[model samples]
Target: MPATAYDAKGLLKSAIRGDDPVIYYEHKRLYRWIKEDLPEEDFTVPIGRAAMRKEGSDITVVSYGLMYHRSLEAVSALEKEGISAELIDMRTLSPWDREIIFESVRKTSRVVLVQESSKTGGVMAEVSAAITEEMFDYLDAPVTRVCGLDVPAIPFAPPMEHFFLPNADKIARTVKKVLEY
Candidate 1:
């Protein structure tokens, strides 16, 4: 499960109680950078459901993990510029919330998928393909992706890493590009 700080407690508890094996990922950078309040009582977030971060009509932005936060930044900027971009946070990859995603696509008719991984064989590839296959007629433009460069591995240097990974600016640019179509 790719969980946010707010969903950490609930997702962790859900993972522990589930029957199937699960791999929970926690971004080290997020530990100190993000904070959220949790319910006082125990709770669980369904493993297959996604969270809708924002709603809009112009376009849809789908992302996960750290990229989800970056996408939020891009969405906020686009809002300031009078572009309304709906944002979806895919909490789980294997069984992503296709209903929510497809619903957003039906409304916006355009989408940009963001990921920190390379463009090739990344999660976005499968997602884009699914959208094309299942919601092709609903689309007004081709699905776009804002992902890391196709280098074998991201560089360690801060400047190189920033250039290689998908950031807020990159995501916003891609979103705007898709919106134009």
Candidate 2:
């Protein structure tokens, strides 16, 4: 659910009212970082729906979890450079919203996927493959991914972990490269 502030309640509700087993990932780093005033009334954010975090015309950035936040930072930087980037928060990855992704890609003609997982066989791989298979003709540039290094595990040291994970600079650089292509 992108590990955002608004997702905690919805995730809890989904877990409580599950027809099947549901697995939820909570980012510990966001525990103190994200806070929001949610609606008092009961509600359930539908599963399998992605959220359009930002809209733009130049390029599309698809991401989930903490990477989604990082992508937004990159998008902000790109905006200052006159590169409008559409950011999509992939709330649910299992049954992701391909329609939204395709629509954005069609409009922008360029895409950059960001994720914290390893570059090898990560969620971005599946997403990039789907885009290539379904929307190759619509793309102006090859799909690019800003992902973690292909390592056995994330490093415990802050510096090493920073280097291992995808950050705003990496995302911004990749987006610029795609736009320039």
Q: Quantify all predictions' global Cα lDDT against the true fold.
A: 0.89, 0.89
RMSD of each: 1.0, 1.1
Task: Identify the runs in model 2 with alpha carbons over 4 angstroms from their true place.
Answer: none
Candidate 1 lDDT by residue in tens digits, 71-162? 99999999999999999999888888999999999999999998888999998999999999999999999999999999987699999988
Q: Tell me which residue pairs clash in candidate 2.
A: none
Model 2, 1-181: lDDT tens digits are 5467777778668767979777787777778898889888887766788999999999999998888889999999999999999999998887889999999999999999998889999888999999999999999999999999998878989999888988999999999999889
Model 1: how far residue 4 lies from native, Å: 1.9
Model 2 TM: 0.96
